[model samples]
Target: MYTTRNSSSSCTQGGFNLGVMHIGAPACGMNAAVRSFVRNCIYRGDTVYGIHDGIDGLVEGNIQEMTWAEVTGWVGQGGAFLGTKRTLPEKHLDQVAARLREYKLHSLMIVGGFEAYHALLQMYEARGKYPEFCIPMVVIPSTISNNVPGSDFSLGCDTALNEITEICDRIRQSAQGTKRRVFVVETMGGYCGYLATLAGLAGGADAAYIFEEQFGIQELQLDVYHMAAKMAEGVQRGLVLRNEKANENYTTDFIFRVYSEEGKGIFSCRKNVLGHMQQGGSPSVFDRNMGTKMAAKAVTWLTDQMLAHRREDGSVFCDEASTAVLLGLQRRSYVFQPVIELKCQTDWDRRIPLNQWWLKLRPLLRILAKHEAAYHEEGITVKEVEEALD
Candidate 1:
């Protein structure tokens, strides 16, 4: 982890209480957002604290003020300015809260994934005791997984997709020699398939497989056989995209065995895990501008609000946790709000063919009942569901 707290400094007007704490590592594209935020804060004459190593750092009193000069030219950089850890507030909630009170922080801005949101809930639970310490938190979704709810695109997803496509494109180039080739490209995102799905589409994969679309072994075999047949007829190459988290190991074993039996001349596959590599490169123009814009919005919201005080001194005490704000693009503007959840249900079976006959004709009664229940819960339409599952 990188520590920048020693280089941090802040300017404050006497009797004014304002500070900000950031918790989380730079594994994703959060570093760009944090640096942009510091620039915006210092430019507006606001005093903020850079707490190293997130919640644990705060509890250990590893706090320092950030200066504009220290955070400039960091908008395009990846990772975080201040170091981050997976520490939870519940571990030492009392000590962490005490540190916030000591710093007299006005608000906090947490940039990370779901773990960061859980920290925000902890801070919200500490209201009504320190009115001067009331801190408003704003979260910027920075995970490559793009699993956060309320936002269509998170900060690091574009970078991750680009990374996967670049790797696959190179692999595709190499596999174009003499024999027919098959390549399996794997991507991160333990629970979500956003990266896999989009990467597959962008990479021009012949077939895309993801946990978001659960497929059975039988169907997978058929798809491979069909692709191999296409290659045998001089197609030369094929692309198979797989989601790492969904069943990478299983899919790889099954494909290799089936391809060998089909006399495809011992077909080969490549596995590319764009892990932390997705977090470090230079930020694209879109990410840099978006980071600055979001930072400005967060600052303005914190400064303009007339929040209630819980202490006798009438100082608005801010909590030391981050809150998630959903900002979705609509038309020509960004709609910022809170989101409840993001749906992630896989319902694909290869055993049953997805032909028109199966989809338009007979439907299983049990499956239909299950579909009704899922629809009531997910707001999805019946036609959108698979015949076997509906």
Candidate 2:
């Protein structure tokens, strides 16, 4: 934050004054990401300010320059150490611009979910209205949902998937001990189904319901039949995972009851909603490393752009790097995508990216789960059914 800290020149003498903040819901690896950002920025001769919260906090002027020792032992830490909120920047754009001017932040880095992304986006769109918002900015996709635009993977998605998979393992153990039983587990992903679909792939669940691919009574009936078939085939236990918002009419308990009624003589059903527990716990090693790498890349990218665009008058020229961007891991490479460019990729109604890369994987999960598809029935086009999915 370094807000109101003796004006911009004091901190800008040696390097640019950069600000980092955690926004939106807390997730594992957030602290780690901030730690890396602070360390990397300082290491590169730049002063890093820790914005206490999201855009709302900026208006309150709760910002401070961070020291390397302050982030000591934050590698595997989880949650928002600097605090966070879900406030968008639309209403407080003027206040945010004032803080940016006061803090003298040459660049800003936000680490959080879609809430943070959208909030920053409001400012990005208003760069012409507020000259202070012209500096380079970037978001490190940190949501467990993995639904942020331009990113194939988000920071905490893997950790949340691991948590869901582990819980599914324990549930499966209980169901296996009591043979011919099915467990309906619900995971949190808001409207996104990345967590549910990935958990299914990792835990070998027989079924995983996601919002991206709509499911209804017919799908539920097919799922029930699949569970019964698994039981009749002498399978010890069955597992089903549903994203919290997978379907409006179908819920975890609803599916459980349906299964219980259909498998009256064959099996029993139990339902477990894994609420906020998935958002807690230390981030996985993969997340810690990924956070470190992504933070380093973001800081480096921002500084490089600022310097390249810096001029004799001390004002940086706007360029590709000056635009607000999201640092996302796409395929094998890490790419920086402009935040404004993501508008078309976003489903504003759902607050998730449109045509998600992982949505295509949902049908594969359904196929692997062995759901009763047209291929298993007569007079139903298998290709049409397959095409209908995802």
Candidate 3:
């Protein structure tokens, strides 16, 4: 086992208290993160607290110190064991600061979606007013949506993708038994289409509709005609995956109706709106390892920041420019990007990253699905593939 405490820091190190909380929706790898964080802190002779139900729980003093044994066997668990809520800490920002002070935490670790990023940023901005908000607060992107900025990959996304792929397999099997059937499946990604695009590739979907790539009625009809062409060519099963919030006008049901009407005697149509089941299941192995490594790195990094900024008076020096950050994976390297620095890369209204890596892979998805669009002659090289996954 790797030593939890870093012995090479330039600054004198001592015991510290760190708190962890889960914010936003429940995710598959969250429990693994919590376990790794608690174990890392305990091994370093530091106190770790589990803040229940996010900022609301923090305001209510629902936090309790975590034990090493409590987190043992949490690696494979799904969803958040610490509980979570999407409630942003805007209104309760003061209460959040007060709780941090009361807990005497040296740093804070947040696990969960874009909302967690927003909440941490709010506290970071208010650090000038409240010293309690000045600690090294870090967010580990754990949402299945994979929408958080500063990160190429979020924690729960792989598991969610696997779930969607398995469900699509089952749906396709049902379609295969038919003479000709076209299925329109809706996936969850808020306004982002990362899941739909990738799932389309994995499930052999003929077309994928995403918010990043706008599609009107004409485009939908064009896709229907293409599906008909494929059916005419003896293709029996057709799959079209669409992001849940891809467009206000083009809904899953509407697409199903359009496909049904256009296909007529050519094929049958079915629609499946995958509900919360996408968020439920044992975390995939990739997610478990990702969460564990991210948590271990975050704990170590936060400690270094805390010790590096420790003032003579024992209070941590609050540096607004570098205090709250997100631990995002950049091409397999652990990047601790300041949350404030992510504003330009973030779509605040949509709660998605402005530069989506998966969007670059859409052309590849289309080409593989035989969509009538010519892509760059380079045809997505291996280097580009690795870079895109970054």
Q: How many residue pairs clash in each candidate?
A: 18, 2, 0
| C-alpha root-mean-square deviation, each candidate | 9.7, 5.5, 3.5
- Tell me each candidate's TM-score: 0.75, 0.90, 0.93
> Cα deviation in Å at residue 102, candidate 1?
0.7
Residue-wise lDDT of candidate 1 within 1-390, one digit each (tens)? 111121112323222334444444454456666676676666657666788887878889988887778876777677676877878686677787788778767666777665564565555555554342245555665666666554556676677778788888888898666476777666766646666667766776666556645667765666666666666666766776666666655665465566556634645555555566655477666666666666666655555431432246745543432232333333245555532221122112321112222222112321322223322433454564454343
Question: Considering every candidate listed, which one attains the maximal TM-score?
Answer: 3
User: Per-residue CA lDDT of candidate 3, range 1-390, in tens?
Assistant: 012244456224557888999999998999999999999888877889999998888899999989999988899989888989988888987788788888788899999998999988888888888888878889999999999999889988999999999999999897656689999999999999999999999999999999988888978877898899889999999999999999998899999999999999999999999988998689999999999998988877887888888889787766657668888887657788888889888888888888976787776676677764423333656665555455
Native RMSD of candidate 3 (Å):
3.5
lDDT of 2 at 253: 78
TM-score ranking from best candidate downward = 3, 2, 1
Taken over the whole model, the C-alpha lDDT of each candidate is 0.57, 0.81, 0.86
**Clash count in backbone of candidate 2:** 2
**CA error at residue 160 for candidate 2, angstroms:** 0.4
TM-score of 3: 0.93
**Cα RMSD (Å) between model 1 and the true structure?**
9.7
